[model samples]
Target: MANPTTPTASVTCSALSYQWPDGTSVFDGLSLSVGRGRVGLVGANGSGKSTLLRLLAGRLRPSQGSVTIGGGLAYLPQNITLDTTPRVDQALGIAERRAALRAIETGDVREEHFETVGDDWDVEERALATLGSLGLGDVELDRTVGRMSGGETVLLCLAALLLERPDVLLLDEPTNNLDLVARRRLCEAVDSWRSGVLIVVSHDRDLLERVDRIAELRSGSVTWYGGGWSAYEEALAIQQEAAGRTLRAAEADVRRQKRELEETQIKVARRQRHNKKMDAQRRAPRIVAGERKRSAQESAGKLRGLHEERLDEARERREEAADAIRDDAEIRVSLPHTAVPAGRTVLSLRELRPRFGRLLRGDLHVHGPERVALVGRNGSGKTTLLRTLTGELEPLSGEARTFVPLRFLPQRLDVLDDELSVAANVARLAPGITDNHIRSQLARFLFKGARAEQPAGTLSGGERFRAALAATMLATPAPQLLMLDEPTNNLDTASVRQLTSALGSYQGALLIASHDLPFLESAGITRWLLLAEELQETTAEEVRDLLEAAAAG
Candidate 1:
C-alpha cells in the first residue's frame, strides 16, 4: 500500500509488476510512495533494490503498473561512462550558456545569444559551485574527461545531475569504488540535499546513516523504518527477539497437545474395557448391551476427534511461528594448510615501479601471517601494485617477489568462468582435487548441494563474490598469501559479514585493497600501507586522519 496523499515532489508506484525476458519475476503488484526527504533503500543482494531504482528513474518500464512522478527527476546509475573527448563545461551541460555569456561580453549583441542565456546567466558559477561541493574545484572547465580518474568521473557525473536541480534524485550504489575522501564528499552532498524526494539504493552503511528514513525492499514489498541504519537494526532486533519467543512457545504448545491426545486415547481404551466387563458381569440382555456398546463407541469417537483437532491447530501455529524467523546463514570454514611459519618471509618488494598509477617507486616486505590493509585514494596504484605482485602486469623497473603460493582476487572477479558451476569453477582452480572435497569446501562457503551446481553467471552479486572467494582460497597447493581488490565494492552488509567470517578461517597472510574502513578494522588488519608516491607504513587512525585532512585541504 502507498500513501496517496503525498503532495508535490513525491513518487508513487501502483500495482507495479516486472519480469525479466527470461520470465524471472522481480516484483509482483508492488507499490510504495516516497515523499520529500532522503530515503535510503536497503536490501539484500538480488532483492530488487537496483531494479526498483531503475523503474523509478524511468530507465525501465513496469510490465503491468503505473509510476507517477509529481515533479522533474534525475538519476545517477551504478555504472557511469562519459565521452572522454568532452570538456568539463560540455559535460556539465553549461557550455551553450557559457558561450552565450562570452559572446555578449565581446559586444556581439546577438539576439540568439540572449535567448540561449535566458535567466541562467550564472550557469557557470553554479556549475563551479556544484563541482566544488563534490571535491572537483581544482578541475578546470576546459579539461578533458580522459584525464580524470574513475572516481573523479563518477563525481563529475553526480555534479552534472546536481546542476539539473531536479525535484527528485535517484542514486544507485554511488560509493562503490570511491576512496574515503570521495565518499566523504558524496556524504556531504547527501547531507546538503533539501526540499525534494531523494532516494538512494546503496549498501554503504555510512551513507545510509545520513538518510532521513529507510525503505527496505524484501520479498517484493517495501517495509518503512524511521531514522537511519542504526535505528532500523535496533527495531529488527526487537522483532526477531519476539519472534524467537513465539516460536518456542508454539513448539511447547504442540508438544503439550500431543501428550494430552495420547492420554485421552489411553483413558478411552480403559473405559471401553471396563464397560465390556461390566456388561458381561451383570448378564444384561443382548439388545441392551448392544445399545450401551454403540453409545460408548460414539462418545470415544467424539473425544478422539476433539484432541486431534487441538493437536492440528497447535502444529499450524508452530509452522507460522517458525516462518517469522529469518535465517541468514553464516560461512564457516577452516584452512589450516594456509598457515605460515612465524619467521618465514611471505612477500618482498624492492624499488618496485608499476606501469600505471601514482607510485614512482616503492619497497615493502611481508612476514608470517601478517594481515595488511592497503589504503589510498583512487588511482593511487593500489590495483597496479597488486597486479604486478601477482605477475599479471609487468613493472617498469624493480622486482616484486613472493616466497609462498599466492592468489589475487581482482575487483572484476574475472577469476570465475561464467559458464561453469560453482563446484566446477573450484575444481578448475584446484586441479587434482576430488569432487567430494570441493563440494564439502563449497558447502562451508554456503553453497551446499544443488546450490553448488548453479552457474556462476546466474549467481547474485553476494553469492558470486562468495563463489569467487571460495575458488581463490580453495585452490590446490594452498595459497599462503591471499590478496583482494575492493572486495566489498557492491556487497550488502550481510554479505560483508559472511566474507569476514570466511576470512576468519584462513590462517594465511592477507593483503586487501579497500576503502571500507570498518571492514578493514573488523578483519584484524595488523598493518596498514598508504599508497602514494611511496609506500608508507601507517595505522588505521592515521589513515582516517590523512583522508580527512586531504579532503579539508
Candidate 2:
C-alpha cells in the first residue's frame, strides 16, 4: 500500500518524476507522503530508494510534478566528507555563536556579537550533548575533524544534522562504515526519535528494527508496511505464500481451460462429421442440408470463440500471478578447484604488525577450508590484517604467508578495471582462459550473455559486486583461499542475500572482516576471531551474547 494520506505529512511528493540528462529515468509518476514517525525505506541496490529520499529532502527538484514540505528538512547523505581543518564547533554550525559568547565574556558588548549569539546561550551545551548522544563524548568541540576516526566523523555529521531539529530528517545508509559500538549508538538515536518525521534509507537491520514502519520502494512505487523490519518480512512471507497459491490455481485454470477448448473442438468436429453423414445418408434437398450445415457451423464457431476467450483470460491471470513473484535470482556455480585439503595449511602469520591501524604482534595459522571471521571495532585493524595477509601491505616486523591461490575482494571493489567489460575483466585475471569459458563462468555469477559484455563502470552496486566476484572466482587455478573485507558494507537486503548464495557455491578457506554479525554467522563461519591487541577465538552464540549484553548495559 502507498503511505497513508494525512494532513500531518511533513514530507510529500505528488506524481513525481525524475530523469537524468542522459534520459535514464529513476522515478516516474511516483507519489508518497511521510508523516511524523520513523519510516525505514529499503529496496534492492538500484530500486531508487536513495533517489526518492533525495527528492523528498529537496536536494533534487522533481523534473515533473510537485514536492510539498510542511517544514524544514535536513538530510545526511550516504558518504560524508568533512574538511579536516575545521573545528568541531565550526563543522556543527555553532562556531560564530561560541566565539561571540567568548568575545562577550572578554567585555566586548558589540551588537553584532549579541546578534550572532542571540538568546540561545546554551548552544555549546546542546552541541556537546548531541555529540555525546552519538558516543563522541571525548571529542572536544575545539578539536579538528582530522583527529577523529571514520566512524566518529559519521557520527559528527549526524550530530550536525540533529542540531538543526528539522521537521523532516533523512538519513541514507548512515551506518555504512560504522563500528559495532557506533552502530549501537546510531540504533539508540533511532530508538529515541520523537521529534518529527524521521525517514531513513538504510539496509542496516539494527537501524531498520528501530523504525515505526517500513516503506519498500520497488518498480517506481512505494509499498508501506506497519512496524519494523521483522514485521515487514513476516508480512512479505505471507504475501508470497498467498501469491504462490494464487499462481498454482491460475495454472490449474489454464490447464482446465485448455482441456475444455480441446473437448469443444472435438465435439464440434464430431457433430460436423455426423451432420455431413446424415445429409448424405438421407439425400435431403440441397437447400435443407445447406441451411442445417450453416447453422451447425455458426454454433460451433460461437462455442469455439467462447472457449478461446476463456483460455485467454486464464492465461492472463497466470501471467499476472507469475508477476507477483519476486525477481531475486540466486547464483549457483561449482568450483571444485577451490577446495583445500583437510590437513593443508592455507595461511601462516607470525608477529605480523601492519603499518596501518592497531594490529599488534600476532601469531596465527589457518588450515584446511576453514571459514574464519575477523571481528573488531572500526579502528581495530580488520582491514589492516586482511591487507597484511594479502601482502598488499608488508608487515612491519614479521612474515605473513599464503600457501594457496588467493583472492581479496576489498570494500572498495576495485578489483575490476572500470574501462573493460565484465568478460574482459575476467579474462584479464585468467589470461589463458578462453573467451567462451570466461563468458560461461560469468553466466553462473548471474552475468549472462549481453550482461557479461557490459562495461564494469556502468553496472549498479550489486551488479558491480557480482562482476568483481566473477572476475575473482573465474581466475585461473581458482582461488583456494578467499578474503572479503566488509563485504556487505553498503549492500541492500537483496544484494546481501545474493552474496550469501554466491558464497555458498564456493569451496575455499575464507577470512572475512565485518561488523555485520548476522551476515558473518550466515556465511557459515567455522571460527570467529575477534581482533584486538591479539586474536581471540569465539563462537556465534558468544558474540551474540556479548552484543546483547552490550545493548542491555
Candidate 3:
C-alpha cells in the first residue's frame, strides 16, 4: 500500500524488478511510495527488506525499474565497519570544516580556508549535538574510532547520517548491535524526526513502536498500517480472524456445491431411466424415440456442466480465503534427556574474569533448569561471560564450570559449516543420530523436507538462525546447559516468537545474554544478572530502571 506523497520529500519506485545473478527473482513489478514521516519497514528475514533499502539508496541498480527521490538520501546498512584511524570528527564528516575554521581564527586570512568553511561555521557544534543525541557526548572529537565500542560505532555512523540532514533516510536493522542505552538514544533520534522520509527496517519492537506508521513488506508487496507495532498487531489480528471466517464459509460453500452437483447427476440419471421406460411403454416410432433419448442426454450434460462450474467457483473462493491467512509455523520439539533434575547443579562460576569486556570479577551458581538473563550495557562483558562459560575463552583468574553437557549459540552463529546442508550440520553436531531422526527433528524447527537440504550459507537470516539453533539443541549429549549470546539480534518478530516457543519446549537450563528485555522476559528468565565491574543479581525492572537512570544522567 502507498501513502499520500509528500510535497516536500517523496520516494517512489516505479515498476521495480530485481533478480540475483544466479537468476533467482527477489522482486518483480513491485512499487511503493513514501511521504514525509517515520515508516517502520517490517518483514521476515530474506524477504528483500535489506535489498529494497539498498536499491533505494542507489547502492544497487534494479534490473528494470526506476527509483525517484525528491531530495538527498542517506543509508545505513546492516553491517557497519568504520576505519580505526579516523578521529570522531572526521568520521562525522566535519573535521575539514573544523580545521578551516581554526585556520581562519589563527589569522590565516586564506581564501581557500574561508571557502572550505563556507556558511556552516557552527558545524562542530552541530556535530557534537548529533553525537550527544546518540549517547556519544563523552566521546572527544579527536578520539580514535578504535577506542569506541561496537555499539558506539553504530551510533557514531548514525550521527554522521544525521549530520547530513538528508531528505530521505534509510536504516537497516539499526538496533541490532546496540545495547539498551544506545538503543534508547537511537529511539530518541527516531522520535525527534519531524521532517523528510525516515524509513527504518528493524526487528526491534521497541524501536518499531516509535514510528508513525508501519509498512509490512511481504510476498514482494507492501501493506500499510496506520499506527505503530501494537496497532499493527491489533489490525492484523482482526484481519486474520475475518479471513478465517471467510475461509470456513468458502469451504462450506464448496461442500454444498459438490453435494448439489452429485444430487443433480443422480436426478438426471433417474429421469433418463424413467423416460426410456416410458418411451418403451408408449411404443412410438423408432426415430421419435431415438430423438427423445438424444435430447434427454444433452439436457443432462448441460445440467452437470452448470453444477460443475459452480463447484469450481466455490473452490476458487476457498483458495483465495486461505491465501489471506498467514501460516507462520512455530517450532515444537521435545527432548526429555535435556531436562535437568531439580537438585542438579547446572553451572558454577568462582571469581571468574573473562579476557574481554569490563567485567573484573564474577561469581555465580545456577541449579536445575533455571533461566538466567545476562543483562548489561555495551562493553560490560555479557558476551565475554558466555564465551568463558562455554570454554571458548578461558577466565583470566578463576574458573567457570558446567556440570552437564553444554552448547553455546553465539551471535555470529558460526557453528554451521557453509558448504554443508542444514541436516548435515545437525548430523555433524549430533554424532550417531540417525539421518531420519535428524530430518524429523529439523522439521519441527520449520526446516521441512527440501529446506533441510539447503546449504547453510544459502539460508536467510531467520532460517540460518533456526538451523544453528537446531544444531545446538539437538547435539548428541543433549545440552543441559544451553548458553546463548544475543540470540534475537536479527530475527524478525515471528522468528523471535518461534524462538521463544522452541525454548518453551526446552527442558534444559538457559543462560542468555541479550539486550532485548521483552524477549528475555518472555523466555521466563528466573534470574537476571547485571554484568559490569562485577556480576550482580538484578530484576528485569531493576535493569530497566538502571538503564533509564543512566540515560537520564
Candidate 4:
C-alpha cells in the first residue's frame, strides 16, 4: 500500500488540441483528468494514445490547451532502443548515478551524504536489486544489451523506471515485447508498487484487467469507464450493439422516405401534365382555366417542399449512422495458401555448437515440420543459435542445414524500409510483380488504398508487421520454411489472433524463437527446444515447468 504522506500526483488537461505539421489533427478539444492509482488507457491505433502520452510526459506541448502534471514523472516509451555496448546495470542506473556523481563533484550535496557514495559497487548492486524485482534477476549485469533478446530489453526499461520511482509513472505499451511470464511479472510489480500513480497505455486484455479503471480514446475524445478489462469490453460491446441497431433503423427509415418522396414527385408531375392538357382542350373557359392552373402550381410547390424536407432528413440520418460506426475503415485481411506438403526433415542440426568468447557453448539437434519453440531466459543464447542456423553467423563447430527456402521475420522488422511507401516496399521486395498485382497482394494483408500509399515510417507497429508479411508472402515463390523471431512484439489482440490463425493453417513448417507462451500455444507447438544453460529437446510440459521454476527464482 502507498504511504499517506507520499505526495499524490494529479494530471489534468483542458481543451487540448494537437495537429501535426502535415495538417493531420489528432486531438481537438480533448480534456481528461487522472489522479492516483493504476489507470489503463485503451484506444485503437492512431487514436492519439501515444500523442496524449507524449503530452502528459511533457515531451510535447499541447497546441491549444494546458496540461498540468502535479508531480515528477517518469515515462517508459513503447520502443526502447538501448546502447548495446553498455552492461545491464550500467544502462539501468546510468541517469541516477550520473546525477549523483555530478551532485558530489559540484559540491551540491553535503559531505554527510558522501557516505551514500561509497563505490560503484553499491550503485551496481542497487541496480541489480531493482531489476531482480522485475524478474530480471539472472540477467548478467555486465552483459551487453545488444546481445539481449527483445523481451529482455523491454524488462530492462521497466527496471529503469522502477529504479527511478517517480511520483507518476507513464508506461506506453510496456508489455508490447514481453512474453507471458514477463508480462505477468510486470503486472505483479505494478500491483505491488507503492507511492506512485500508474498510467499504462496498452491493448493487452490481461494487462488492462489489472488496472483499476479504463479510459478509452476514440474520435479524439476520451471516455472513462470504471472497472477492469472485462467491464470496459462489456461497455464497448453494448455501445457498439446499440449503435449498430440505430444505424440499421436509420437506413430503413431513409429508404422508406426516399421511396415516398419519389412517389410524391411523380404524382405532382402527372397532375401538372393533366392540367396543361385540360387548358389546351378548353381555352375559352377562363375561370376554370385559372382555377385549375392555380391548383396545379400550388400542388407542385407543396410537393417540392416536402421532397426537400424528406431528403434533408435522410441526409441527417446518414450522417448519424456514419458517426455511430466506429472505425468502419478497419482493415481485414485474408491469408490464402496453396497446399504444400511438409517434408520429414525441415531443418536439421547435428552436434551444433556456438560460443561468445568464453561465455557460452551449446550442442543441439533440431528436426523439422515440428513446431519447435526455442525457450529460455534472457541472454540464454536462443538468438545465437537462430543466427547460426540461418547462416547469418557461423557456429563455432558442427553442421546446420535448412533444407527448404526459409523466410525469416526478424523481431525488428528489419526487411522494411521506413522511408518507402507500403506498396513500394512490397514492390521492391518482390521485383517482377506489376503495381496492380502488388496493390492486390497488399490488400490481402490489410494495406488498402491510401493506407498502402502511406510511408512505412508513418505506420503503427501492427500495420508495419502486416506490411512486412505482405511483402514476404507475395514473393514469386513463397518460402516453404517460415522462421519468426518474436513475431508478436507489438501487435494488438486482434492482430495476434489473426496471425495465429493464419500460421495454424499454414502448410509450411514453422520455427519460432519466442518468449510468447500464449502465441506458441496457439500455434500448436508441441515440441520444445529448451535453450537455457544447455540445449535439450523436451516436451511442452517440461518447458512450462522450467519457465515456472525460472519465474519462481
Q: Who wins the lDDT comparison?
A: 1
Tens-digit lDDT track of model 3 for 220-311: 99999999999999999999999999999999999999999999999998999999899899998899999999999999999999999999
Minimal lDDT window, size 10, model 4? 330-339
Extract clashing residue pairs from model 4. none
lDDT of 4 by residue, 266-294 (tens): 98889888878878887748888888788
The alpha-carbon lDDT assigned to residue 402 of candidate 3 equals: 87
lDDT of 2 by residue, 85-159 (tens): 999998899999999999999999999999998777998999999998888888999999998889889999989
Over the stretch 17-123, how does candidate 1's per-residue lDDT look in tens digits?
99988899999999898889999999999999999999998999999999998877889999887899999999888898899999999998989999999888788
Runs in model 1 with CA error above 4 Å?
Answer: 1-7, 272-298
Q: What order do candidates take by TM-score, descending?
A: 3, 1, 2, 4
Candidate 3 off by > 4 Å = 1-7, 279-289
Using lDDT, rank the candidates from best to worst: 1, 3, 2, 4
lDDT of 4: 0.75
- Deviation (Å) of 224 in candidate 1: 0.9
What is the lDDT of every predicted structure here? 0.93, 0.88, 0.92, 0.75
Error of 3 at 368 (Å): 0.8
TM-score of each: 0.95, 0.95, 0.96, 0.83
